[model samples]
Target chain A: MSALIDLFSVAAIGAGLFFFFAGTVGLLRFPDSLTRLHALSKADNLGLGLVVLGLIPRAENPLAALKLLVVWALVLLSGASTAQLIGRALRRGRK
Target chain B: MSVLPALDVGLALLVVGVAAWTIAARNLFASVVGYVAYGLLLALVWVRLYAPDVALTEAAVGGGVTGVLLVTAGKRLDALASAEVGVPPGRALKILAGALAALVAGALAWVVLTLPSPAPSLAPAAAEAAAGPGAGLGNPITAVLISYRSFDTMLEKVVLILAVLGVWSVGADAAWGAAPAPLRKVRPDGAMILLAQFLAPVGLLIGVHIFWVGADAPGGAFQGGALLAAMGMVAMMARLAEPPRIDSRKLRLALVAGPAVFLIVGVAGLALADNLFAYPQNFAKPLILFIEAFMVLSIAVALPMLVCGPPNGSPK
Candidate 1:
């Protein structure tokens, strides 16, 4: 059971890494500001979320797991709001 | 010998790549976003390195708080005419700098991995020693932070209060405008508003739970405080609670309450206990709990105020 959990954890972490790489590549390759934001918003939030999920089982106790959850939730909220704010500003600039 | 090291190496490379793109990006907005992404990844690196407390702080303040600040600044800057910045640094310079950074990072990583394990971490020892007499809290971090290291925590609150004062002093003239129109109208009946309302309360409850549980668990004052602040943010955005006016005495009180309470408690400790800020061993848990609860309220108000800039009046 522990081995399976560990395997699952590793897979989740790998997925996070993939998203991070994709986000970075998009940022470098994309031409427009909006597209780059798209890359960042999509990848960074999910990447961090997955990483946290992977670490959940490894947490020393329930409190640690709760902490991880708080971290994840904060990332999700801040990521989306900030991205939205940036997108609005970009549109305003275009006008 | 282990797979963890390999995973760490891979993540480090990815982080390096993202940071390079972020710093070198042509568009300022893209660069800001990249910086945020880099901070998030850096937090993950911290977690891999076995510093969960630092990871939490980095993720919240570094990734979340700083990201919002940068994005707001970028929005404000967007109105100015776009002037093309100078050419990117030469490839040779980039390579030289990159090589040097890599060398330093490599050396540091080597030192960290090679360091001999101490017989016992100060944290566990402090927890055990304090459990019998000083601050009888089972959680080492909390005991260390609010008791043994209470002076540092007191000063940190002062720094936060000073920061709020500085913001008010400088940007006192700016009006409290609604978050861009789209966000303002967030449809009274929108599903998102309903969801936020539902989630906000639950999040607050959990935050309190974490705060209460911190005495023996992984949660603590910072996480609890951040979660509480997040609830306040959700309320402010959903228009469930109006943004307080700059001149409102209530707003001022909330801003100052954490530091004032901390100082009072610290001084009281001096009178009641042998040392300054030496929380009474019997009531240490409750004392820390009260301090954390108030600190959470203060942080929630102060952080948003910082992001909102100077409050002119209630947002229309």
Candidate 2:
């Protein structure tokens, strides 16, 4: 059971890391503000979500697992909102 | 053999790189962003050193509140347009400043290196007291902050109140009793309003929980209160609430409540216990928590007020 859990955790975390790397590359290489933000918000959120999912199974207790989820949720909420706000500001500045 | 050392080295390098960027960044706003990132990275270093309490403090005040304060100041300066970019220092001045910085760093390094083989520490004494007379709090940091150093804690709250007063006293006489300028001049759109609505309550809950768990955990009143203040700022930014009038009775009351309650308790302690700040043996935990609750309230109000600065808006 532990071996199976570890395998799943490692696989999920690897996938998450790939997305994070992709997000960083996009953020650095994207030509425009909106596109960079698009790469960042979408890719990073999925990356963090996957990482959280991977870690939850290894949490010491149910509360710890729940706390991990809460962290991800809060990050997602803030990320999405800030991305929208930033995009709006960018549009306004161009105008 | 272990990757931990490499990770630590990398973290230290990252912190230094960010700090250097913060110093060297040409744009004021970019420097502030670098500063914020530097603070967060320093907080991570603190965590690696097994100092979660300090880490929380660094992350909240150093990164979060200070970032907001600086960004707000920068925005105001930009809006005023009177803030001319100052001329850069000449080569001689730059070299002199570098020499001075190097001298300070070298002196610090010398002092640290010349310390006795077994450096003095109060950890043993603190541990003894914390496990015995210091109210048996599970978290040694809390015990030190509240039980062992109650006077310092109370005075710290007083200092915050004093800071708020100091900020207020700078206002023009006409702006007295008025609110500070709104944090956001632009009307917040739907997304911001929704973020504030969804996040504030959850943040408040987490803040309280952080404070509540402080007796046995890494969280504390300052960290929790900082989070609460951040939430309040978010609400203000989203136009869900306005910064209160400086002279509002309720606002004044909240500002002073923490230190006032703490002082009153300390005075009462002289009668209840032998020392000025001592709690009775049986009631220490409850009293500490009670005092901390008020401290949290005061901190939450004081920080946001500090960021808002002296009142600038006309009286409502």
Q: State which docking tier applies to candidate 1.
A: incorrect
Per-prediction TM-score, please?
A: 0.67, 0.96
DockQ-based class of model 2 = high
Scanning candidate 1 chain A in windows of ten residues, the lowest lDDT window is A74-83
- C-alpha RMSD of each candidate structure in angstroms: 7.3, 1.6
Model 2, span A9-66: residue lDDT tens: 9999989998999999999999999999999996769999999989989999999999
* lDDT (Cα, tens digit) per residue for candidate 2, span B1-316: 5899999999999999999999988787999999999999999999999999999999999999999999998987888875546676899999999999999999999999999979988778767657654565778888888767778888898899899999888999889999988888878889999999999999999999989888889998999999999999999999999989998999999989998998888888899987787788888888888988998999999999998889996776
**Which 10-residue span in candidate 1 chain B carries the lowest summed lDDT?**
B176-185
Against the true structure, what is model 1's DockQ?
Answer: 0.11
Listed models, DockQ each: 0.11, 0.90
TM-score of chain B of 1: 0.76
TM-score of 2: 0.96
